[model samples]
Target: MATPTITLVTAVPNPATFGQSVTLTATVIPLGAGTPTGTVTFTITGGPILTGTLSGGTTSVVASGLSAGVHPVVATYSGDNNFLSSTGSTVIAVVHASTTTSVVSTPDPSTLGAPVTFTATVTPVAPGAGAPTGTMTFVIGGSGGGLFTQPVTAGVATLTLSTLGIGTHPVVAIYSGDASFLPSSGTDTHTVIPAS
Candidate 1:
């Protein structure tokens, strides 16, 4: 007769940020003597199915690229000839990652009507991994000034202009948060002098 077995599941960093990898471990314990030998199948709701080979009665799998939401995970132990099958479950919560934006203008002090390029770089805060995706809104010269939007490519957005009135312009770059990243903003100052 096959011996009864118990399975238990646990997740490291239960509350993880989007794009962060999560480790899932399944432990199989035999009700009777001896360790259970076999494999474990992990099923993640809204994610992917992973299979792991049991080692010393425990097996682990790494999961990444999870969207921001609650995911239910189930671990099924594929019992050996001497052990009966068992199952365990756990929950993982993924939240949006925070980001920081920094803006820079080339040719800080330039002549009026000269092309000036403004660049914005967006980076994820600590504990968050991967590049952020979304659009960037450039607000030039405070309120009522020129407003331009650009798509972010590899965590960067840029805009070029040469029509600013001669003076000091306060430029702000606003990042439009995506499903995996939170919104952020940065500022820069550009001075335009009469064509020299």
Candidate 2:
């Protein structure tokens, strides 16, 4: 009897987002010349046990609805008459997807050169998942469009602009995203009027 070596192959985007589907393929190779034909069982830590039939010494399965964290996966080969069983393991890191980000500018209609405060509020798709921690990129539109990065605190980021020209300015705030959340953005318009 020959020894069967099992290899596990994980799909791309290993640091997958929550609710995303991840595929795992296993290949069985026999030490001897004959091919290994049998069933492969896959087990995920804190997840489920799946089985796949090997055709040409290979089989695969998809995993979904995984929480945000590192998941340990193992593939075991059921040896046939000519081969001995073996197992391989790998780890997958899953993250959360951005839900929504809303931006609002105070003093929407204000005098030119007056300080205007912009606030960004970010919300995660899954409340129990975790809080989002990152920076927010603020981009202003118009003749005097400018951009700057502000660190988020408790899912909120703030920026103040005082050199805005007298016109309609479009403002946008983008969340740079962190390990648990994906990037997200929001937009709002600020109007500056001539000072009397």
Candidate 3:
């Protein structure tokens, strides 16, 4: 008389997408002279267009091709070939490729040097949520954004260029995303209120 043993392998992706490869391995192996052979079947759980019957082994299939986006790869083994064997299964998720971030510049204030506030937003081209996790650099007249780095409760960002000298001071805000998102200002002015 013999007893049937089976174990499931966790820590695997679900519903793997198309155009990807996956591997199935056995786990929760009991300590003993367990029979290391039997009839193992590999199939996509709850998925269509996937079929195959594989042999038994501790670990099989270096990598198998699949469609994409979370393909469940199951590996099963029959314990009849050995004195004691455990049925094991694993799943792997395969997903499509991700494209690079595509961010554009928002309309900045035309005038430069003026004590005008502005907000530079970065948007990704992909159909996802949340803003791109990156830094938005704000530079002013060959100098760092001293106070510009200040946080804004709302969504808008403010840039204040104090009344320095005169000339056409260039007040620009550069957004730092993947590479660099620089939305510059044309030419804001700093009207020097004549000191009486």
Model number with the top TM-score: 1
User: How would you encode candidate 1's per-residue C-alpha lDDT over 1-196 as one tens digit per residue?
Assistant: 9999999999889899887899999999999998898999999998999999998999999998889999999999999999999999999999999999999999989788889999999999877878888999999993225999999988999999988888889999999999888999999998888886
Worst 10 residues of 1 by lDDT: 138-147
Error of 2 at 63 (Å): 19
Of candidates 3 and 1, the better by lDDT: 1
Count of clashes in candidate 3 = 22
Better of 2 and 3 by lDDT: 2
TM-score of 1: 0.94
Per-residue alpha-carbon lDDT of candidate 2 for residues 94-172, written as tens digits (9 for 90 to 100): 8677658899988889788889899999887752245678999999998666999999887899999888899999988
Where's the lowest-lDDT run of ten residues in candidate 3? Answer: 178-187
Pairs with backbone N, CA or C atoms under 3 Å apart (clashes), candidate 2: none
- lDDT at residue 57 of model 3 (Cα atoms): 32
- Candidate 3 local Cα displacement, residue 65, angstroms: 3.7
TM-scores for every predicted model: 0.94, 0.55, 0.35
Candidate 3 lDDT at 159 equals 46
TM-score of 2: 0.55
True-structure RMSD for candidate 3? 11.8
